[model samples]
Target: MGARVTIVFAALAAIHTLTPTAQAADAFATPAVTINRADWRAAMDQLRSELNAAPEVAADFALTARRRSVAADDPRQRPALVQLNGVTSAIFTGIGRSPVPVLLPFDTTAYLAARRKGAIDPQALPRHQADFQTDLFDAGPSGYDAVFSLPTEATSGLPSRVFARPVEIQITGSVLTYDVADPAGGKGESVKALAAQYPDLRRFIREGYVRYAFTRFGVPYVVSIQCLDSAPRPRRLACREASPIAERFLKALRIAGGQPRRLPPEIAPAAIERPPAPDPDFTYRPAGDIVVNSGARGQSGRADLTAYSQIRYPLDAPAYVHSQSFGRRRASDKFDQPWSQYPWRDNFCEARSFNVGQCASGFGHQGQDIRPGACPVRRDGPEACDPWRQRVLAVRDGVVIRSTRQQAVTVQVNTGTEHIRFRYMHMNPSALDADGLLNGRSLREGQPIGVVSNYLDHPNGTTRHLHFDVQLFTRDGWIWVNPYMTLIAAYERLIGGRGHEIGTEMVSSSVAAPAITGTLPPAAGPQADAVHAPN
Candidate 1:
């Protein structure tokens, strides 16, 4: 908003570029606090023993994210269904290990009877595993469990981030919590009533999924039964039926994570900066600039005023911010059409595969497509580019949460009071698998994750460009948001200066963007006439 504030943000972004490889690696170098594994393990063991003494509620009540063999030796301190202490609660003290212990007041008899009434065997309910972010969690037969947002730096021991946290946190479902990706929340009488029980609870439906979010012990937890279309009547398995059960879980929820100290309130990201239109030739489209099936236009869309994360630029080399598919074909747009050149356009909500709630139409592209620095010279006396040569960097210090073989690599960053996720696409999944970028991996900010390459379902399914987006933690869990402003800020810091906003009158739809002066990276110039590789 102010020149002074812009300068401050620019300075911070500079830090990302200036020094990159420092995280837990710089532990001894700096006076930063670190936690030892022995100490962490000891603290957890103590917590487990305390719970065993308090109330050893034992029941075979179903609904869990973990697979348990009926014949396998039960790891609980007490035998299954033994009623160790009047059976007023249930303790999921993780089998085969005691890393995380959960104690909750549950009516074992009533739960069992209800399952039987519905003609379902409570004890025999299948343990439907939770899928990666691509699909929903199989919430078992009862459709509920004291789910935990695991894979966090505290819960999982990622080599780089394991020792980074000053204190460890306990999440329910223990090791099984690893499969549970984003915190999903949903609605109904059950959800509303459950929300009522917690103070400062935020409730909403994200992309048809209802959610309830609240903070406790300085960390945020979300509960969702994954229901949708709560119209004239509450959808089955929606929050209504879950209300009573959820209320019970919250009432019995213990701050078992053993968070030693309270966390401060979340600090909202900075607001959008509106610097004066510094250059007429430096044109760009505004947010929610919904492109028709076949209509290309110059500047005129209004700017969106949402705040975005100020993270590191994703690419190491220079890149052009443009659309890979603006070559809609109806206009005979060539593979190397100048349409892919500068005067960077905002394609966050462009028509593409996938759904985005941030888009005005509620469904479209979930990220911004960027082409890395100009293609290198070819051996055949021409300048052709290879996307695989460009390096893709980790935007921040975070844990890799994407499943094995999953195409999109999502890194979850849980620092301070913010829980954010950054996603990178187009890189081949097979390469990632070989590189050990699998789930629970730790990544430092600015680390070279992999080289950019075009690999959708098959090789080069789309153009050679990086489809990047940002997802913020909200009442409805993790959902996609536009990264336009964030990228602009990051680019400003990347190239060491600010970019001017060009007005509509200065642009023409019939022609591609003309080259201009600024801090923009290579390939920002007109590429309409340049011969390039096949998509």
Candidate 2:
């Protein structure tokens, strides 16, 4: 028992001796991942506080960190809350170009409401999400108006505004103006299909651009890159090289969800105007009915049928719809006779140096031709029409997208319901430049653009008339669709009366067209502004 007691004491002594060492080891040793959770939590709280203070700063928190409780936020922070809670975020140009792709989270309810105004069928929209604003640099890249990136909203009560924007990207050796639209409306293929087709993207879109369309989170997205092969070799970038760049952009897209919110009034459904149906009194020839004879354009005849829009009569005064051909007439005379008399003709499919996908032949004049109102008093000069008197007018409320040193000025109407561009041609380029009718100019409906003149490539290259045409946002970029229907619709509205369509045989034969006449709206008063487009 004494020996046992001695052993126990010795054991206890050994334990007592090791206690200090073990305590020292415990002090040295620590968890493999002993997270500074306190510090981490503090940082998160700091970020949330900053975001709440200035919702726009949420863009600063992109990958850093990021929400869904607007009701819980302070009332003043409501807009900022949404703006901050993924409800409001801005993509700021980083110190340099950001390596990250942008995620433009949309309010699903607001998106649907905008489409409803555009006459989009509610059932046709994707169930989880309606139509998505395309990621086209043209779309998300391109702003509908020159004003700002997203639709402008100035609601009286809101302290802040919600907006979506893409992260800016840099592409060397390629020239892209950053316009937007791909799968603009309707739907597109799945992301998998787009990936499969990415290798040969040119086959998918018109204009030979590398275009990939895919859907994510039930939203359709399109990304297009032009070969710019036409660009210098050192600067040239093709689809093969551009596909990866575009793919990266696609990868960057993420959905930022916010609770249901109302859209701005301008694009809201209540403000939308439905396009009119074909009026029985409004008569026009079937679209694509090219006089079928380009050589005999001097004696051209064929009234054209048209499409919709809230548009002003293109002409400031009542005008004659006739052939104002660029081609020389059979005789010394410009196209062998009176250029203004008409049963209305269609030149949208007339022969041209370029290709027009809308034409049956895939190559023709891109637009319709309309002459000045007075044909009887033909004047001799660079233009046959009275440039000082007769004029062309803005067809819709829009911005001037194209005003070149060449011969055309294109005004673009880019609202939720309309993505159409109106081109005015034949007026002298010098004159347009003089009037400050250049890109990014603002215009209202019925605003005087320029006078109808005969300036084609040069002065008097074509007959004195407005070579008016239009283009719509399509998968093929800005494909020139036949504006015959749109023009007819605008004219009928302008005249405040109905027009009956006439037959080609009636104009081709000895019978003269029953002069369809209507006076211009009193509001279409003369303005010094004149505009110009392609021949």
Candidate 3:
């Protein structure tokens, strides 16, 4: 009765092992394109609206840089010194309040001296000039502000003992004209004092007018002033209070300032927003084995075959048959062929004569030489073996971590720490479709992708064969496994061969499987119970 029960249990286990779950669906799908024109248009519209509402206004006023001469003979024509270059203007555009433009004059010589040492090229005069202009106007919506370096020289009178020292003259003015009697006309004195010091009053007014235009039109302004002294030879001159004409002109001018107000909110609206791009699809799984042949009669000492010596066989047995047999091919007739027809015959001949295993020396051949019928070979080129080529499918579903199509190899990583890599080489370039895989799609067992080419240089000239190699990574480094063992295991399962023992061994060896903490399941019979009971 125990024997019968044991047999029954064994049969049940076999039945359960025969059925397996279906593979998961492919993760990748064709991507689509999307565009949003309305969002872009809305942003542009907002910018235009802001510009149209409460447009910019500019005001002009004259300022003077003057020096006094110690010449009693020509006091009326006192020596005058003025800024010839380097002036900047600023304008501030408030979101709700009135726009205000501020003009700050600079010492042009000092500005140029500092700028030449750091920001601008001292040697390139034109570039320096252009940069000065840019710095003056590009002060953003903030009002114009700057310092000017006024150039000075001595006028005739005591043999010109000294030079005029540079000074900054601040000028305030309005773009619109107004009478001193107006409520806002108090600002005129400040503007007049700003211009009273310079002898070149006309040039000052011209620059002031230009500045007003730029401010009014939302442009920037800069100017240079040049001055000449008209006193007797050999006299020292001070740049202040040099010219009465300039002082009179400034005194006659008037400026006004009105209270500012805010612009309406309806003129400017918020800009539209944009969405992000889609994320990439990802997948992960363990690699499956490829089976070649099954149920071939086991020769004596088969169990003694080491991993390195697994694929050794007689030369006359056609390369393709040997590969298929080792890989456990189900259909023996599919790959049976003569040795002479094999593409690697010449290389094999050389290996045989040299006793180098590259041919038939047998032990530790390094890499498997899959034949034409089992795995397509390209004698002419990569395209020649397209029809008979093996798919060289990905070991596991994963993102293409690294690809070297130029070298005909692709490495994929399933997990960050797994460190397990699969390399598929000698594949035809065309095999990788637009999506970068076989036919731009997923591959199955025994599917055709592209033929192996002779691009990889071998010991001989080059051999036309698939050089499929597997390398396992350990903490120390990589270790090569006799892939034929795994291949044969998969093949035997598919073709009616007894695989229960192998399956049990694999389950026991798998690193991913959970530990069996309890006793083994009940055996089929009484004899089986004795064999498993605490032993």
Residue ranges of candidate 3 with Cα displaced over 4 Å: 1-366, 372-390, 399-402, 408-419, 429-449, 452-454, 457-464, 494-535
Which window of 10 residues has the lowest lDDT sum in candidate 3? 526-535
Question: What does candidate 1's lDDT look like per residue over 65-142, in tens digits?
Answer: 234554455434233222222232223321112222223233333334444356544343221101101111111110
Alpha-carbon runs more than 4 Å astray in model 1: 1-205, 208-220, 223-255, 260-283, 290-302, 327-337, 378-387, 510-535
Candidate 1 to native Cα RMSD, angstroms: 15.9
- Tell me the alpha-carbon RMSD of every candidate: 15.9, 25.3, 35.6
What lDDT does candidate 3 reach at residue 340? 16
TM per prediction? 0.53, 0.51, 0.24
Top candidate, metric TM-score: 1
371, model 3: CA deviation in Å?
A: 2.7
- lDDT leader: 1
lDDT of 3 by residue, 241-342 (tens): 223222322332211111122212211111111112221211111111112111112111111111111111211112331221122123233333443122
Segments in model 2 whose C-alpha atoms lie over 4 Å from true places: 1-286, 293-306, 326-339, 375-389, 403-406, 509-534
User: How far in Å is the alpha carbon of 170 misplaced in model 3?
Assistant: 66
The TM-score obtained by model 2 is 0.51
Indicate whether candidate 2 or candidate 3 has the larger TM-score.
2
